[model samples]
Target: MAVFRESNAAPYLQPVPPVVGDAKVGGAAPHELSIGEIIRRERRLSQEQIEQILQYQREKGVRFGEAAVALGLASQQDVLFALSQQFNYFYAPDAKRGYSNELVAATQPFSHQAESFRAIRTQLMMRVFSQDDVRRAIAIVSPDSGDGKTFFAANLAVVLSQLGGRTLVVDADLRGPRLHELFGIESSSGLSGILSGRAETSVIKQVPDLPSLYVLPVGVTPPNPVELVERPAFALLMRELLSKFDHVVVDTPAAVYGADATVIAARCGAALVLARQGRSKVSRLQDLVATLNNSPAKLAGVILNEY
Candidate 1:
C-alpha cells in the first residue's frame, strides 16, 4: 500500500488538493511531490495583484517574471531562474545530477519563506556545526510531506558550503525518498545501499551547483527499510560521512514514520522539528514530539513551518 502525491506545495491562496498515486515507482514506498501545474498555480495572482505586477515592471524596471520570482510567487525552479536573472548570477549545475542553474534563482514566493527558514537554519548550523558537533547535529525536521524539508536540506547545505564547510545530506527515508529529486539526480544509492553493501563509501554523490553539498538518496525503496536503518553498516556510513564532510545533515525519514527517524537519532546528535502552521494538526505535532522522545537524539528545538 504505497502513498503518492502528484505535486509540491502551491501558494497558500491557490492550493490544489493533493493527488494520491497508487503506483509505486519500482515498488518503493509511497510519497508525494507537487507537480508542475500545482507549482504554477501557486503563482496565480488576483487581477489586482496582476496589475501591481505589471506596474512594478513598468515603474521599477523589474519584469513581471523577475518581480514574481523575487516575491516568492512561483515554484522553486521559477524562483531560481528569476533571481539569477535579477542578480546577475551564475552557478554550474552538477554534471552528474544535471543540477540546474535555475536552483540559484529566487522567486517572491520562495524568497519570502526562505528568508525566515534560512535564518533559522543558519542560526542552527552556527550553533551546532563545530568541529566536534558536526557529526552529531542532524537536522531531522518534522513530518512535512510538502513544506520543503528536502529543499531546506539542499539549500541549507549550500549555505554551509558558502561558509567553507563540506556538507552531505544523507536521505534516510528508504520507504519514501525524494532527496535525489531535489538535485534532479538518480536515487539509486543511499542508506539502503550501504546497508546492503551494494555501494561503497565513494558512491556518495557530490551534488552539482552546491559543490560542498553531497548526497545519498534513499535509493530504490527497500522492501523492509526498518532492518536496513538498524544495521551497523548504516552507522558506519554516518561516521565515515562525518569524517569526510565538515557538516553532515541527515534528512531522515519524516516524523510520521517512527523507527527510521529514531534510528537517525540514535546516530546523530540534535534534531530540528518542523511543523506547518495552518496545514499541520496539533495531534500530528504531538505525535511527532512523542515519537522523538523515544529516540536517542537530543531535542535541539522546534521549527514551526511557514507556508
Candidate 2:
C-alpha cells in the first residue's frame, strides 16, 4: 500500500537519525542484519520499541517486521527495503536493461506489480508447499494462446528466485517457446534434446544477473511436442529437475495443444490457470478446468492477469 516514486536511485540507504528510539550502536552491516535488526538499525527504534514489537509478534503469531509496521514504528517501505537488503535482491526501476520490460519482478522490484507476484508466491508456498502432501513441480496453463501464461510464469519464477530458493522455469511450450527470448538465452538445445537423448548434458541455462534462477528452453521445436512430453523420459526428467531445484515452474502451451498442457500439469502434479482480462472466455476456461480436474494435477488457483 506504500507508493514509491519511479527512480533509479538505490531503494535502501543508511538511516539519517532516530525517529522513534535511540540510534543503534555499531553492529552487523546493513545487508548482514536480520529483518528485526535491520528495522532496529534503519528506523532507530529503541530497544523497548523493538521488544514491544517482538511481544506483539509472539502474541499474534505474526512476523516482527509486520508487527513493527502495524505499530507505526516503521512503514511498509522500511520493512521491504530491509527485506531486500537482507536477501540481496536487486531493484531496477528502469526497464530498458535487456530483460523484458514486462518482467516487473526483475525490472521493478518495489512496484505494485511485483508485489502482486510476491503475494501469489506466498499463497502458493502456503497452499502447495506447506501441505503434508505437497507438490514441487507446477505447470502454468491457459485455455488459449496470448493469455499471458508465459509472461506470468517468467515473472513468478523470478520472484520465487528472489526468495533465495533455487527456482527453475522450464519452457514446455514446444510449439511456440518464448522463455528463451524472455531470458535472452540460446535455445540451441534444451527439452527436446534432453528428451531425445541427442544432448548429453542438461540444457538448464542460468540467468546471468539472477543467480538463483535457471531456465530450460524448448529446443528445436520437434514435430511431435505432445509425443515428446508423453514419453516416460519426460516424467523422469521432471523428477530429476525437481530433486535438484527448490521449485520447478513449467510454462506449457494452451489447452488447445491437444492435451499437451494437461499432460505436463499431470506430470508436475500442480497447475496454475492464467486468464487474461477481456481476452479469456469464461466458457473456455471452465472447459479447461474440467479437463484438468480429470488429470492427476491439482488446480492450484486461477490468476486474472490484468496487464
Candidate 3:
C-alpha cells in the first residue's frame, strides 16, 4: 500500500481532521498522558482553565480537544500537538523542538508535502527494504548541486523513521556536507572521522526528537573527500551500518563534482537520482543516468524534485 499525495496546498487555517494513515503505520501503544494533560502542559493552562475545559467537555458532549478549542483555551495546533502526544505520532507543531521547519515531515506531518515524502518512503520500503531484502541503504544522487538531493534524503529518512524502524542518514558528501545543518545537530565528529580512523569518540548522534532517526555527520572536512570515499573502509562502513539499521540513506556529492557519488552508490547497492524541475539540464541528467546505469548499483528510481 504505497501512498501518493500531491496536494501541496497551504496548511489548514482551522483544525480539520488529522490526515488518515495513523492506523496503517501502526496503532499507537497506550500512552500515559491524556489529551487534556498534554494540552495543559504545552499551553501552560491553569488549574481553573483545566476545570473549565472539563466542564465544557461534559456539558457540550465534545472531546477534550474540541472543547478546548471552543473555549479558546488552546489553539488548533495545540490540540494537534496534544493528539500527537496521545497517539505516539510525533511532530513539532510549534517548532519548539524536534526538527527545524526544513524537515517538513517532522514539523508538518499532516501537510501535503509531508505526505508526499511518506509516499516516496512507502515506495522505497516496498522496493529496496522489504523484510527479506539484504540491501538496506540507498544513495541519493543528483546531476548537480541544488537539485534538492540533501533535502529529499533528509525528509525521506524522517518519514521512514516515522514507521518506527531505526533509520540512519549518512552524510557521505564529505566535500560539502549539509545534512548536519539540516538536522540541526553538531558535526564535530562523523563519517569522515570514522572512515579516516581519527574519531576517538562516538560519531553517530541520535536526533533528539526522533528516537528512531540517527545521523552521521561529516566530522572534520578532509582535504581529500574523493580519496576518503574511495577507500575500502567506506564500503565496509556502509555494509556494517546496513546490518545495524533498518534503513540507511547516503547523501552523496553531485555527479558533476566527481566520481564520488557513483562510487558511493555502488557501495550502497542502490541509488535514487534527483532532478530539479526547472533548473536541471536534460543532457546533464541523461549523462548522470547513463553513468549510474553503468555502475554496480541498482537504479531504484529518478525523482523529479518539485520542491
Model 1 regions lying over 4 Å from their true place = 1-110, 131-134
The sequence of per-residue lDDT tens digits that candidate 3 reaches over residues 1-307 is 1222111111111122222233222244324567877788778899999899999999999999999999998999988877776666665575768466788888888888998888888787777777464775899999999998888889899888777667789999988999998878988887877777776676777786566788889989898998888888887787778766778999999989899999999999989989988888999989988998999888888888876
List pairs with backbone clashes in candidate 3.
none
Number of clashes recorded per candidate: 26, 0, 0
Model 1 Cα lDDT, one tens digit per residue, 1-307: 0001011111111211111132222342122322322223335566666666567667879756665555555544654533432232323322333553323321222454435545655566555664343457475666646655666565556555544456667787676677777677766555676577665444467654344456767776788887877777666666666665677777766766666776776777666666666776778777777777777766666665554
| 65-167 per-residue lDDT for model 2 (tens digits) | 8999889998887777677665567343344446777777887787788898998988888777777655469999999999988889999999888777678
**TM-score against native, each model:** 0.62, 0.72, 0.87
Scanning candidate 2 in windows of ten residues, the lowest lDDT window is 1-10
Per-model C-alpha lDDT, please?
A: 0.56, 0.78, 0.79
Question: What ranges in model 3 sit over 4 Å off?
Answer: 1-30
Which 10 consecutive positions of candidate 1 have the poorest summed lDDT? 1-10
